[model samples]
Target chain A: MTKYSPPLAERIARGIGHLMFLLGGTWGVFIALPVSVAIAADPIQLAIWGVFMGSGVVAAFAAWRGLYLIEYATIPAMAAGTLIYVAAITNVVATGENPGSGLALFLMIALFSYLTARWFSLNQLLDGPLKLLFKRRQGLDE
Target chain B: MSIGTVITLIAAVLGSSTLAAIITAFVNSKRNKSQSETEARAQYTVEFNAIVAQQNIQIERLEKRVNQLEKAEDYIDVLIAGITNGTIPPIPPRI
Candidate 1:
Protein backbone atom coordinates (compact mmCIF):
# COMPACT_ATOMS: atom_id res chain seq x y z
CA MET A 1 0.00 0.00 0.00
CA THR A 2 1.27 3.43 -0.99
CA LYS A 3 4.36 1.87 -2.49
CA TYR A 4 5.26 -0.02 0.69
CA SER A 5 4.86 2.15 3.68
CA PRO A 6 7.20 1.42 6.58
CA PRO A 7 5.54 0.67 9.90
CA LEU A 8 5.90 3.30 12.57
CA ALA A 9 7.37 0.84 15.01
CA GLU A 10 9.98 -0.28 12.51
CA ARG A 11 10.86 3.33 11.77
CA ILE A 12 11.28 4.04 15.44
CA ALA A 13 13.33 0.92 16.04
CA ARG A 14 15.67 1.75 13.23
CA GLY A 15 15.95 5.31 14.39
CA ILE A 16 16.90 4.26 17.89
CA GLY A 17 19.40 1.73 16.61
CA HIS A 18 21.04 4.29 14.37
CA LEU A 19 21.11 6.79 17.16
CA MET A 20 22.91 4.35 19.45
CA PHE A 21 25.48 3.77 16.75
CA LEU A 22 25.99 7.49 16.30
CA LEU A 23 26.27 8.12 20.00
CA GLY A 24 28.84 5.38 20.37
CA GLY A 25 30.79 6.78 17.47
CA THR A 26 30.58 10.30 18.80
CA TRP A 27 31.69 9.26 22.28
CA GLY A 28 34.61 7.36 20.83
CA VAL A 29 36.07 10.47 19.26
CA PHE A 30 34.86 12.82 21.92
CA ILE A 31 36.74 11.01 24.67
CA ALA A 32 39.75 9.95 22.64
CA LEU A 33 40.77 13.39 21.39
CA PRO A 34 40.86 15.04 24.80
CA VAL A 35 42.55 12.09 26.44
CA SER A 36 45.22 12.06 23.77
CA VAL A 37 45.87 15.75 24.27
CA ALA A 38 46.26 15.34 28.02
CA ILE A 39 48.70 12.41 27.73
CA ALA A 40 51.01 14.30 25.35
CA ALA A 41 53.72 14.47 28.02
CA ASP A 42 54.96 10.88 27.67
CA PRO A 43 55.92 9.95 24.10
CA ILE A 44 55.01 6.25 24.32
CA GLN A 45 51.85 6.94 26.29
CA LEU A 46 51.02 9.78 23.96
CA ALA A 47 51.44 7.55 20.94
CA ILE A 48 49.20 4.91 22.50
CA TRP A 49 46.57 7.46 23.33
CA GLY A 50 46.68 8.94 19.85
CA VAL A 51 46.27 5.54 18.19
CA PHE A 52 43.52 4.56 20.58
CA MET A 53 41.60 7.74 19.95
CA GLY A 54 42.33 7.65 16.23
CA SER A 55 40.39 4.41 16.08
CA GLY A 56 37.38 6.29 17.39
CA VAL A 57 37.64 8.56 14.41
CA VAL A 58 37.72 5.55 12.15
CA ALA A 59 34.68 4.09 13.84
CA ALA A 60 32.83 7.39 13.55
CA PHE A 61 33.41 7.57 9.81
CA ALA A 62 32.52 3.92 9.37
CA ALA A 63 29.12 4.50 10.98
CA TRP A 64 28.63 7.72 9.06
CA ARG A 65 28.97 5.79 5.82
CA GLY A 66 26.90 2.83 7.08
CA LEU A 67 29.74 0.46 6.26
CA TYR A 68 28.50 -2.42 8.39
CA LEU A 69 29.49 -5.35 6.22
CA ILE A 70 33.06 -4.36 6.91
CA GLU A 71 32.20 -4.41 10.59
CA TYR A 72 30.98 -7.98 10.23
CA ALA A 73 34.07 -8.91 8.30
CA THR A 74 36.58 -7.67 10.86
CA ILE A 75 36.24 -9.59 14.10
CA PRO A 76 39.98 -9.57 14.61
CA ALA A 77 39.98 -5.85 13.99
CA MET A 78 37.56 -5.18 16.80
CA ALA A 79 39.50 -7.53 19.06
CA ALA A 80 42.69 -5.72 18.28
CA GLY A 81 41.12 -2.35 19.02
CA THR A 82 39.80 -3.63 22.31
CA LEU A 83 43.17 -5.06 23.16
CA ILE A 84 44.85 -1.74 22.51
CA TYR A 85 42.53 -0.01 24.90
CA VAL A 86 42.95 -2.71 27.49
CA ALA A 87 46.70 -2.62 27.24
CA ALA A 88 46.75 1.15 27.64
CA ILE A 89 44.55 1.01 30.69
CA THR A 90 46.57 -1.75 32.27
CA ASN A 91 49.72 0.20 31.70
CA VAL A 92 48.24 3.23 33.39
CA VAL A 93 46.79 1.36 36.34
CA ALA A 94 49.94 -0.61 36.99
CA THR A 95 51.99 2.59 36.86
CA GLY A 96 49.63 4.44 39.15
CA GLU A 97 49.46 1.51 41.60
CA ASN A 98 45.69 1.35 41.25
CA PRO A 99 44.73 -2.22 40.40
CA GLY A 100 41.05 -1.26 40.56
CA SER A 101 41.44 0.97 37.54
CA GLY A 102 42.60 -2.04 35.54
CA LEU A 103 39.40 -3.80 36.48
CA ALA A 104 37.41 -0.97 35.00
CA LEU A 105 39.22 -1.41 31.70
CA PHE A 106 38.60 -5.15 31.77
CA LEU A 107 34.92 -4.71 32.50
CA MET A 108 34.48 -2.15 29.74
CA ILE A 109 36.19 -4.36 27.21
CA ALA A 110 34.11 -7.33 28.28
CA LEU A 111 30.89 -5.43 27.91
CA PHE A 112 31.92 -3.98 24.60
CA SER A 113 32.89 -7.38 23.25
CA TYR A 114 29.65 -8.93 24.44
CA LEU A 115 27.56 -6.23 22.84
CA THR A 116 29.50 -6.45 19.58
CA ALA A 117 29.01 -10.20 19.42
CA ARG A 118 25.30 -9.82 19.95
CA TRP A 119 25.07 -7.18 17.27
CA PHE A 120 26.96 -9.36 14.85
CA SER A 121 24.69 -12.28 15.65
CA LEU A 122 21.67 -10.11 14.94
CA ASN A 123 23.15 -9.06 11.63
CA GLN A 124 23.66 -12.67 10.71
CA LEU A 125 20.04 -13.44 11.44
CA LEU A 126 18.90 -10.66 9.13
CA ASP A 127 21.44 -11.62 6.49
CA GLY A 128 20.55 -15.30 6.36
CA PRO A 129 17.13 -14.85 4.73
CA LEU A 130 18.42 -12.23 2.34
CA LYS A 131 21.24 -14.48 1.24
CA LEU A 132 18.72 -17.12 0.19
CA LEU A 133 16.74 -14.59 -1.78
CA PHE A 134 19.86 -13.28 -3.47
CA LYS A 135 20.82 -16.78 -4.52
CA ARG A 136 17.39 -17.28 -5.96
CA ARG A 137 17.63 -14.03 -7.86
CA GLN A 138 20.99 -15.03 -9.24
CA GLY A 139 19.61 -18.37 -10.34
CA LEU A 140 16.79 -16.59 -12.09
CA ASP A 141 19.22 -14.29 -13.86
CA GLU A 142 21.33 -17.17 -15.10
CA MET B 1 47.81 9.09 40.65
CA SER B 2 50.18 10.59 38.10
CA ILE B 3 48.78 12.72 35.32
CA GLY B 4 50.20 10.32 32.74
CA THR B 5 48.40 7.37 34.28
CA VAL B 6 45.17 9.25 34.43
CA ILE B 7 45.49 10.23 30.78
CA THR B 8 46.24 6.68 29.68
CA LEU B 9 43.33 5.18 31.59
CA ILE B 10 40.87 7.67 30.14
CA ALA B 11 42.22 7.12 26.61
CA ALA B 12 41.82 3.38 26.97
CA VAL B 13 38.18 3.70 27.99
CA LEU B 14 37.54 5.99 25.06
CA GLY B 15 39.29 3.67 22.64
CA SER B 16 37.23 0.66 23.67
CA SER B 17 33.96 2.55 23.41
CA THR B 18 34.94 3.75 19.97
CA LEU B 19 35.57 0.19 18.83
CA ALA B 20 32.13 -0.84 20.03
CA ALA B 21 30.51 2.01 18.19
CA ILE B 22 32.27 1.21 14.95
CA ILE B 23 31.42 -2.47 15.22
CA THR B 24 27.78 -1.64 15.89
CA ALA B 25 27.60 0.58 12.83
CA PHE B 26 28.87 -2.14 10.55
CA VAL B 27 26.49 -4.74 11.89
CA ASN B 28 23.55 -2.34 11.58
CA SER B 29 24.31 -1.57 7.96
CA LYS B 30 24.55 -5.24 6.98
CA ARG B 31 21.25 -6.04 8.64
CA ASN B 32 19.51 -3.10 7.04
CA LYS B 33 20.64 -4.12 3.58
CA SER B 34 19.56 -7.69 4.19
CA GLN B 35 16.09 -6.60 5.33
CA SER B 36 15.53 -4.40 2.29
CA GLU B 37 16.61 -7.18 -0.03
CA THR B 38 14.28 -9.72 1.58
CA GLU B 39 11.30 -7.39 1.25
CA ALA B 40 12.13 -6.82 -2.39
CA ARG B 41 12.23 -10.55 -3.01
CA ALA B 42 8.88 -11.25 -1.35
CA GLN B 43 7.33 -8.54 -3.46
CA TYR B 44 8.71 -10.06 -6.63
CA THR B 45 7.37 -13.47 -5.71
CA VAL B 46 3.85 -12.13 -5.22
CA GLU B 47 3.89 -10.39 -8.59
CA PHE B 48 5.25 -13.43 -10.40
CA ASN B 49 2.64 -15.67 -8.87
CA ALA B 50 -0.14 -13.36 -9.94
CA ILE B 51 1.13 -13.26 -13.51
CA VAL B 52 1.34 -17.07 -13.68
CA ALA B 53 -2.18 -17.50 -12.30
CA GLN B 54 -3.60 -15.02 -14.79
CA GLN B 55 -1.84 -16.80 -17.65
CA ASN B 56 -3.26 -20.17 -16.58
CA ILE B 57 -6.80 -18.77 -16.49
CA GLN B 58 -6.40 -17.38 -20.02
CA ILE B 59 -5.11 -20.75 -21.28
CA GLU B 60 -8.05 -22.59 -19.75
CA ARG B 61 -10.50 -20.25 -21.44
CA LEU B 62 -8.83 -20.76 -24.81
CA GLU B 63 -9.01 -24.54 -24.37
CA LYS B 64 -12.74 -24.40 -23.68
CA ARG B 65 -13.33 -22.29 -26.79
CA VAL B 66 -11.45 -24.82 -28.93
CA ASN B 67 -13.61 -27.65 -27.52
CA GLN B 68 -16.80 -25.72 -28.39
CA LEU B 69 -15.55 -25.09 -31.93
CA GLU B 70 -14.97 -28.84 -32.47
CA LYS B 71 -18.54 -29.62 -31.36
CA ALA B 72 -19.92 -26.94 -33.70
CA GLU B 73 -18.01 -28.41 -36.62
CA ASP B 74 -19.51 -31.84 -35.98
CA TYR B 75 -23.05 -30.38 -35.95
CA ILE B 76 -22.42 -28.58 -39.21
CA ASP B 77 -21.16 -31.80 -40.85
CA VAL B 78 -24.30 -33.63 -39.74
CA LEU B 79 -26.50 -30.87 -41.18
CA ILE B 80 -24.63 -30.96 -44.52
CA ALA B 81 -25.01 -34.76 -44.70
CA GLY B 82 -28.72 -34.51 -43.99
CA ILE B 83 -29.24 -32.01 -46.81
CA THR B 84 -27.19 -34.02 -49.31
CA ASN B 85 -29.07 -37.23 -48.51
CA GLY B 86 -32.43 -35.38 -48.49
CA THR B 87 -33.07 -36.87 -45.09
CA ILE B 88 -34.97 -33.66 -44.36
CA PRO B 89 -35.85 -30.97 -46.91
CA PRO B 90 -34.50 -27.47 -46.13
CA ILE B 91 -37.29 -26.37 -43.76
CA PRO B 92 -40.06 -27.32 -46.31
CA PRO B 93 -40.87 -23.83 -47.66
CA ARG B 94 -41.38 -22.19 -44.29
CA ILE B 95 -45.11 -21.49 -44.37
Candidate 2:
Protein backbone atom coordinates (compact mmCIF):
# COMPACT_ATOMS: atom_id res chain seq x y z
CA MET A 1 0.00 0.00 0.00
CA THR A 2 1.10 3.51 -0.76
CA LYS A 3 1.70 6.01 2.01
CA TYR A 4 -1.24 8.27 2.63
CA SER A 5 -0.81 12.00 2.77
CA PRO A 6 -3.45 14.24 4.23
CA PRO A 7 -5.20 16.67 1.93
CA LEU A 8 -4.09 20.32 1.75
CA ALA A 9 -7.12 21.62 3.56
CA GLU A 10 -6.64 19.12 6.34
CA ARG A 11 -3.04 20.16 6.71
CA ILE A 12 -4.00 23.84 6.74
CA ALA A 13 -6.62 23.27 9.42
CA ARG A 14 -4.09 21.49 11.60
CA GLY A 15 -1.60 24.26 10.98
CA ILE A 16 -4.18 26.78 12.14
CA GLY A 17 -4.70 24.78 15.28
CA HIS A 18 -0.99 24.84 16.00
CA LEU A 19 -0.89 28.58 15.34
CA MET A 20 -3.78 29.13 17.72
CA PHE A 21 -1.97 27.22 20.41
CA LEU A 22 1.21 29.24 19.98
CA LEU A 23 -0.57 32.58 19.85
CA GLY A 24 -2.87 31.81 22.75
CA GLY A 25 -0.03 30.63 24.94
CA THR A 26 2.11 33.61 24.06
CA TRP A 27 -0.72 36.09 24.61
CA GLY A 28 -1.55 34.57 27.96
CA VAL A 29 2.03 34.82 29.15
CA PHE A 30 3.10 38.19 27.76
CA ILE A 31 0.07 40.34 27.01
CA ALA A 32 -2.50 39.27 29.59
CA LEU A 33 -0.11 38.87 32.51
CA PRO A 34 1.65 42.20 32.07
CA VAL A 35 -1.55 44.08 31.38
CA SER A 36 -3.25 42.65 34.45
CA VAL A 37 -0.27 43.52 36.61
CA ALA A 38 -0.07 47.04 35.19
CA ILE A 39 -3.71 47.64 35.90
CA ALA A 40 -3.42 46.24 39.43
CA ALA A 41 -6.40 44.01 38.76
CA ASP A 42 -8.21 42.74 41.82
CA PRO A 43 -7.95 39.16 43.03
CA ILE A 44 -11.24 38.12 41.37
CA GLN A 45 -10.35 39.62 38.02
CA LEU A 46 -6.92 38.07 38.17
CA ALA A 47 -8.42 34.73 39.02
CA ILE A 48 -10.80 34.94 36.09
CA TRP A 49 -7.99 35.82 33.78
CA GLY A 50 -5.95 33.03 35.24
CA VAL A 51 -8.70 30.59 34.42
CA PHE A 52 -8.90 31.86 30.89
CA MET A 53 -5.15 31.68 30.34
CA GLY A 54 -4.88 28.39 32.13
CA SER A 55 -7.53 26.92 29.91
CA GLY A 56 -5.59 27.84 26.81
CA VAL A 57 -2.44 26.34 28.26
CA VAL A 58 -4.21 23.17 29.27
CA ALA A 59 -5.98 22.87 25.93
CA ALA A 60 -2.74 23.32 24.07
CA PHE A 61 -1.06 20.66 26.12
CA ALA A 62 -4.01 18.35 25.67
CA ALA A 63 -3.93 18.87 21.94
CA TRP A 64 -0.24 18.12 21.89
CA ARG A 65 -0.78 14.92 23.82
CA GLY A 66 -3.76 13.88 21.69
CA LEU A 67 -6.10 14.01 24.62
CA TYR A 68 -9.20 15.06 22.76
CA LEU A 69 -11.67 15.07 25.63
CA ILE A 70 -9.53 17.39 27.69
CA GLU A 71 -9.37 19.82 24.76
CA TYR A 72 -13.07 20.48 25.21
CA ALA A 73 -12.15 22.32 28.39
CA THR A 74 -11.50 25.40 26.27
CA ILE A 75 -15.18 25.84 25.47
CA PRO A 76 -16.20 26.56 29.05
CA ALA A 77 -13.08 28.60 29.60
CA MET A 78 -13.94 30.78 26.63
CA ALA A 79 -17.48 31.17 27.90
CA ALA A 80 -16.20 32.40 31.21
CA GLY A 81 -13.80 34.73 29.48
CA THR A 82 -16.60 36.13 27.38
CA LEU A 83 -18.72 36.72 30.46
CA ILE A 84 -15.90 38.52 32.20
CA TYR A 85 -15.37 40.72 29.17
CA VAL A 86 -19.05 41.67 29.22
CA ALA A 87 -18.84 42.46 32.90
CA ALA A 88 -15.71 44.55 32.45
CA ILE A 89 -17.29 46.56 29.66
CA THR A 90 -20.47 47.12 31.65
CA ASN A 91 -18.47 48.30 34.64
CA VAL A 92 -16.55 50.74 32.50
CA VAL A 93 -19.78 52.14 31.12
CA ALA A 94 -21.25 52.44 34.60
CA THR A 95 -18.23 54.39 35.87
CA GLY A 96 -18.59 56.95 33.07
CA GLU A 97 -15.45 55.73 31.35
CA ASN A 98 -14.97 54.98 27.65
CA PRO A 99 -15.52 51.27 27.02
CA GLY A 100 -13.96 51.19 23.56
CA SER A 101 -10.99 49.12 24.70
CA GLY A 102 -13.19 46.81 26.72
CA LEU A 103 -15.48 46.35 23.75
CA ALA A 104 -12.54 45.56 21.54
CA LEU A 105 -11.23 43.01 24.00
CA PHE A 106 -14.66 41.44 24.14
CA LEU A 107 -14.78 41.16 20.39
CA MET A 108 -11.34 39.63 20.28
CA ILE A 109 -12.24 37.05 22.89
CA ALA A 110 -15.42 36.23 21.01
CA LEU A 111 -13.56 35.73 17.76
CA PHE A 112 -10.92 33.57 19.39
CA SER A 113 -13.55 31.43 21.06
CA TYR A 114 -15.32 30.94 17.74
CA LEU A 115 -12.17 29.84 15.95
CA THR A 116 -11.12 27.51 18.73
CA ALA A 117 -14.52 25.93 19.02
CA ARG A 118 -14.81 25.39 15.28
CA TRP A 119 -11.34 23.89 15.15
CA PHE A 120 -12.10 21.37 17.84
CA SER A 121 -15.48 20.49 16.42
CA LEU A 122 -14.19 19.92 12.91
CA ASN A 123 -11.16 17.96 14.03
CA GLN A 124 -13.24 15.39 15.91
CA LEU A 125 -11.78 16.36 19.25
CA LEU A 126 -15.14 15.89 20.93
CA ASP A 127 -16.60 12.54 21.90
CA GLY A 128 -18.98 10.92 24.37
CA PRO A 129 -21.62 13.39 25.51
CA LEU A 130 -20.53 16.20 23.26
CA LYS A 131 -20.61 13.93 20.23
CA LEU A 132 -24.02 12.65 21.21
CA LEU A 133 -25.27 16.18 21.68
CA PHE A 134 -24.10 17.18 18.22
CA LYS A 135 -25.68 14.09 16.66
CA ARG A 136 -28.92 14.77 18.45
CA ARG A 137 -28.96 18.37 17.32
CA GLN A 138 -28.37 17.28 13.75
CA GLY A 139 -31.07 14.68 14.04
CA LEU A 140 -33.47 17.29 15.27
CA ASP A 141 -32.57 19.56 12.45
CA GLU A 142 -33.18 16.87 9.93
CA MET B 1 -31.14 50.08 24.80
CA SER B 2 -27.94 51.85 25.69
CA ILE B 3 -25.09 52.23 23.20
CA GLY B 4 -23.10 49.54 25.00
CA THR B 5 -26.00 47.18 24.69
CA VAL B 6 -26.38 48.01 21.02
CA ILE B 7 -22.71 47.38 20.30
CA THR B 8 -22.71 44.17 22.28
CA LEU B 9 -25.69 42.97 20.31
CA ILE B 10 -23.97 43.71 17.07
CA ALA B 11 -20.82 41.97 18.19
CA ALA B 12 -22.75 38.92 19.25
CA VAL B 13 -24.45 38.75 15.87
CA LEU B 14 -21.17 39.12 14.07
CA GLY B 15 -19.47 36.53 16.25
CA SER B 16 -22.22 33.95 15.72
CA SER B 17 -22.21 34.42 11.96
CA THR B 18 -18.47 34.18 11.77
CA LEU B 19 -18.62 31.03 13.85
CA ALA B 20 -21.21 29.56 11.50
CA ALA B 21 -19.04 30.27 8.50
CA ILE B 22 -15.99 28.71 10.12
CA ILE B 23 -17.97 25.64 11.08
CA THR B 24 -19.29 25.23 7.56
CA ALA B 25 -15.81 25.45 6.05
CA PHE B 26 -14.35 23.02 8.55
CA VAL B 27 -17.09 20.47 8.08
CA ASN B 28 -16.85 20.68 4.33
CA SER B 29 -13.10 20.24 4.35
CA LYS B 30 -13.30 17.27 6.70
CA ARG B 31 -15.95 15.61 4.57
CA ASN B 32 -13.95 16.12 1.45
CA LYS B 33 -10.86 14.65 3.02
CA SER B 34 -12.69 11.53 4.17
CA GLN B 35 -14.31 11.06 0.77
CA SER B 36 -10.99 11.32 -0.96
CA GLU B 37 -9.37 8.87 1.40
CA THR B 38 -12.12 6.33 0.83
CA GLU B 39 -11.80 6.69 -2.89
CA ALA B 40 -8.08 6.18 -2.69
CA ARG B 41 -8.50 3.04 -0.62
CA ALA B 42 -11.03 1.63 -3.05
CA GLN B 43 -8.76 2.30 -5.98
CA TYR B 44 -5.87 0.68 -4.22
CA THR B 45 -7.92 -2.41 -3.51
CA VAL B 46 -8.98 -2.73 -7.12
CA GLU B 47 -5.44 -2.39 -8.35
CA PHE B 48 -4.16 -4.87 -5.80
CA ASN B 49 -6.81 -7.41 -6.82
CA ALA B 50 -5.93 -7.01 -10.48
CA ILE B 51 -2.25 -7.62 -9.82
CA VAL B 52 -3.01 -10.69 -7.73
CA ALA B 53 -5.24 -12.09 -10.49
CA GLN B 54 -2.54 -11.54 -13.09
CA GLN B 55 0.00 -13.30 -10.90
CA ASN B 56 -2.37 -16.20 -10.34
CA ILE B 57 -2.82 -16.66 -14.07
CA GLN B 58 0.92 -16.68 -14.59
CA ILE B 59 1.34 -19.23 -11.83
CA GLU B 60 -1.31 -21.51 -13.30
CA ARG B 61 0.40 -21.48 -16.69
CA LEU B 62 3.75 -22.28 -15.06
CA GLU B 63 2.20 -25.19 -13.16
CA LYS B 64 0.73 -26.71 -16.34
CA ARG B 65 4.07 -26.48 -18.14
CA VAL B 66 5.82 -28.12 -15.20
CA ASN B 67 3.34 -31.00 -15.22
CA GLN B 68 3.83 -31.62 -18.94
CA LEU B 69 7.61 -31.63 -18.54
CA GLU B 70 7.35 -34.11 -15.66
CA LYS B 71 5.14 -36.51 -17.72
CA ALA B 72 7.52 -36.33 -20.66
CA GLU B 73 10.48 -37.15 -18.44
CA ASP B 74 8.66 -40.17 -16.95
CA TYR B 75 7.70 -41.52 -20.38
CA ILE B 76 11.29 -41.22 -21.61
CA ASP B 77 12.55 -43.08 -18.52
CA VAL B 78 10.04 -45.90 -19.12
CA LEU B 79 11.08 -46.22 -22.80
CA ILE B 80 14.78 -46.40 -21.83
CA ALA B 81 13.99 -49.09 -19.22
CA GLY B 82 11.98 -51.16 -21.81
CA ILE B 83 14.92 -51.08 -24.27
CA THR B 84 17.41 -52.08 -21.62
CA ASN B 85 15.24 -55.08 -20.52
CA GLY B 86 14.28 -55.97 -24.16
CA THR B 87 10.62 -56.35 -23.01
CA ILE B 88 9.47 -54.33 -26.04
CA PRO B 89 10.85 -54.76 -29.60
CA PRO B 90 13.57 -52.12 -30.25
CA ILE B 91 14.10 -50.51 -33.65
CA PRO B 92 16.27 -52.70 -35.98
CA PRO B 93 19.87 -51.53 -36.41
CA ARG B 94 20.38 -49.61 -39.68
CA ILE B 95 21.94 -51.92 -42.34
lDDT of 1 at A37: 31
As for candidate 1, its clashing pairs are A68-B26
Q: Model 2's lDDT to the true fold? A: 0.51
Q: Which candidate leads the pack in TM-score?
A: 2
Model 2 docking category: incorrect
TM-score of chain A for the candidates in order shown = 0.40, 0.48
TM-score against truth, every candidate:
0.32, 0.36
lDDT of 2 by residue, A4-77 (tens): 43455554454455446446535654676443222334554455445554455555554444433334434445
RMSD of each: 16.4, 19.5
Candidate lDDT scores, in order, read 0.51, 0.51
Interface RMSD of the predictions, in order shown? 9.7, 11.0
lDDT of 2 by residue, B1-95 (tens): 54334434534554454355345434444433323333434555676899999999999999999998997777777778888898965643422
